[model samples]
Target: MPKVVLVGERELRDLVPLDRAALDAVRGAFLALASGRVIMPPILSMAMPEVHGEVDVKTAFVPGLDGFAVKISPGFFDNPARGLPSVNGLMVVLSATTGLVEAVFLDNGWLTDVRTAAAGAVAADALARPDARIATVFGAGTQARLQMQALALVRDLDEIRVWARDSVKAAACAADIEAATGVRTRAVGEPRAAVSGADIVVTTTPSSAPILFAGWLAPGQHVTAMGSDADTKCELDPAILARADRLVVDSLAQSRRLGELRAGVAAGAIAADAAVDELGSVLAGTAPGRPGPDAVTVCDLTGTGAQDTAIAALARARADAAGAGLATDL
Candidate 1:
């Protein structure tokens, strides 16, 4: 009987700290994805409009890797009213050679949260100006806080401006991040007020409509939107991508299907055949990023299977070294 492991969220959290190591792992996943050898299919998404919820299934197999991860993520938009988290799910890591389950990550969604944030860090490092400092974030959710911590790794961020529909939630989020990052975190009522003059802007809202407009952007600014991972979700105005000097996506296909790019393509603000570069291309040096100091760049992240597998592998290895998880025979 082969051995199977169950790694729960407690151990996983102790292993992955949303640090540089995790960022590099996600970076490797992007590079491997850009190699064109990975077998990543379109995300499988099902919407529960009646309940204001959604579930997405994503996975990828990178050649030469020992295993792959399949993630089942569910987002119940109305869960908060019931005093439950809006997002929660798990990942199943399987052996590449035998296609047998090696481990089950009962992370409940922490793995997804960190990997998504790590992707944001990778995009920011590759696209944001080298000297970027101030950052403005839209949304006061988990990703909103994690994204800021991740971006701090690549940029010398000393100030963080946050905007959310709920002013009180925004204020509390700002206070927490301010203490955690030692960065001046301020909660603003207006979205534009949060974005104006910012070097890096990150949108982490699950808003269905545009909360961020292109007119609020300035030259030399870079934006990474990680909120819109479903067809019904959009945080930035579609026209925002049209004005950017470059449009990069974690996966152009995924973006067109669900990410912020979908809104633009659907609205006719961007051509279907418009040249779009994947974030992996830039990370691999096959394409240019941050064209100039004043160039505007936008990266649409729709979460990838490659990332899920990579982070799962990293967390598993670390947990193994730390003697974590429950071992079982199957």
Candidate 2:
């Protein structure tokens, strides 16, 4: 029998914050993905359309890590109406040497939120102009607020504008970001008004249709699309990919099947065999990012199993150091 540790969300939040350490962990994951022979498979997704819900199973085995993580994430969109969160899940860490369960993170999706936002920050840091200031985010959900906080970690943001279908929620989200980051933040009624003139634009919605159009983009602007992780969801117009000077994705294979690139290819806005750069390759300097200040760049993030493994490993190590969680032998 192996000893297994169980850590809850409240403790995990204190252990892994959305700070430089968390950012570095995710960044290192991308670097390892690019430079090492990591074993990460395609996402296993099950759609429960009858209940407006979906579950995704993701995992990865990095070469140097002592353990790997298998995460099960479920999103029930209608849960909010029932006084429940829309997203919740846990991660199971297994020993690399013995393949036995070492720990279970009952983070309830907090880890995913942190890592996803960190990935967005990494993309903006790598692709956005060094002097990028203003930012616009579409969607007022958890990711919208976290993305702004994460961007504040890497970029010297001056202003953040939020736009959502529900204007009231957008205003609340804007107020929260301003208070949290001390950056001037506001809510706008028009999506175009939110996108125009922003140096970095991030779409964090679970919108099924296009909320960001191609014509709204400007040169020298960078876009991070993190919402289109499912085949049915799309935030950016397919034409936006066609118009980007440099396009990047977390995983080319996943993007082709589940990210915005799928819509682009289906709409013929981008080539089926387009030369797209992976975020890891860009971070590793194997591929180019933002060729010049005037270039328009876009990064499509469909989320990845490597991130779960990375964050989980970090949480487990930190918990051990802090003497957190409950250990039991079975």
Candidate 3:
């Protein structure tokens, strides 16, 4: 039996933060995905509608990496009422050469949150205008707050706007972000008002219906829809996809099945076989990103297994270097 390291959330948090290095790790994952050397499969998900919960299992194998990761994430919307968190999960890293478990991260979804936020930052960095200063985010949840913080890492944001169904939560979220990022932040009652004059707009809600309409978008704006990671969720109107000057997705196959593109194709707003660009391709310079300053671009991120593998690999490397975590042979 090989020795396996068990790392908890506290250590993982200290190891992998939503910083430049974390962003770089996620960026490398995208680059590897674009290089066609990564082996990532479709997400395995199970819906527990009775409890209003769902669990997703994702993993990927990246070339040149010593190990890969498998992550199991669960989201229970009603858990808050029971004094429990809505999201929680863990990750297991396996040695690529030996096919043995190398480490288990009992992060309880902390790594997922960090990597997801990093992906948003990477998408914004690659697609948003270099001079982007204003950002609007929909949803007053953990992801909404993290997305704003992540965006600040790559862009010099002058202001941030938050809009959610619950006005009080939205306001509170805004205040927290302002205090954390030291950027002017406010809560907007109207969703359109929140998006108006914003250079970058991110939707982070798990809305089943569209929250952002096509008419609300303007030129020179970049939209990142990170909420629609399932077939049942949609944040942007289907027409938004048709109107975007450039449409990019984390994965074309995943987007077509789970992201906004699914709704776009179903509504006949976009061609089912349209030639869309992947975010990895854009980052790799193989595909264009932001045709011009005035072009409207949209990137739909349904999340990816490659990110899990990347972040997990980083965490393990950091733990090894710092002599952290508990090693056990089983």
Candidate 4:
């Protein structure tokens, strides 16, 4: 019989302890994200006026590991009226050799948020300047909040400026981030102001059009764009590629086909080989990052399956140590 461990969000809250271990795991996993080691298919979603939702199914297999895990995150984005989050989901672990169902983690997307945030931190730690203080974050959603928290773990932040399409929403998001991270967070009136003078910038919006312009950034800045995980979504202008001294992506192939690089190449703003490096190469010490104090770098992260595998492994280990998971015979 295959044993299935069921873990809920509350249980996951206990499983995730904010620390460097989380960052390391995600970074290491991502460094090896390419070469078919992990499998993260695209998210399937649908939107109607009455109902809007998406399912992100991710799986990762590390060679020599006992098992691999898959996370099937399905959530409805229309629950704001009910005072609930627009994002929610769970993870499932499975046996590698037997392909049997091993565990089911019902975290309601908390673990996913943490893992994704950790990924952002990893990207910043590798590509951003050591003394980075100011950070500009786009979007006032859950990702914006988590990205801030994750970045705090990597850099010594002084102030954070946030921008959303709506001023009220931007202010509200900034306030929430300030209260949570205790950093000097403020809302910006424009997207450019949000990035101006900032050593590091993060874009987390879901916009299909460009939310940031190339002319707004200065040298010696690092940018982590998290909005364009799909082909239909883009948050930065293709011309921005010309401003970046280094363009590092989580996956080169995926970015070429669907990320900001795709649009940049399509628009003739950047060449296909213009990307000086990828994040994995930097992490592996094969490539340099932020070449100089005045070098501008961009880290494009389109969610990876390796991240899901790493987090699922951690969750399973924690559950086993605490004896918190139920072993169901299936």
lDDT at position 91, candidate 3: 98
Per-residue CA lDDT of model 3 for 122-223, tens digit only, reads 999999999999999999999999999999999999999999999999999999999989999999999999999999999999998999999999999999
Question: Per-residue lDDT for 162 in model 4?
Answer: 94
The lDDT for every candidate, in the order shown, is 0.91, 0.94, 0.94, 0.81
lDDT of 2 at 33: 88
What RMSD does model 3 have?
0.9
Q: Clashes in each model (backbone N, CA, C under 3 Å)? A: 0, 0, 0, 0
Q: TM-score, each model?
A: 0.97, 0.98, 0.98, 0.91
Q: Give the TM-score (vs. native) of candidate 2.
A: 0.98
- Compared with the true structure, model 1 gives a TM-score of 0.97
lDDT of 2 at 24: 89
Alpha-carbon runs more than 4 Å astray in model 4: 34-51, 81-84, 272-276
lDDT of candidate 1 over 1-330, digit per residue (tens): 588889899889888889999999999999998999989988888889998988989899988778899999998989989999988999998999999998899998999988999999999999999999899989898888999988888888878999999999999889888877889999999989889989999999878999889998999999999998888888889889899998899998889988888999898989987899999999999998999999999999988999999998888788778878998995
Residue 70 lDDT, candidate 1, scale 0-100: 95
Give the least accurate 10-residue stretch of model 2, judged by summed lDDT.
Answer: 35-44
Per-residue CA lDDT of candidate 2, range 74-138, in tens?
Answer: 99999999999999999999999999999999999999999999999999999999999999999
Which residue segments of model 1 deviate by more than 4 Å? 49-52
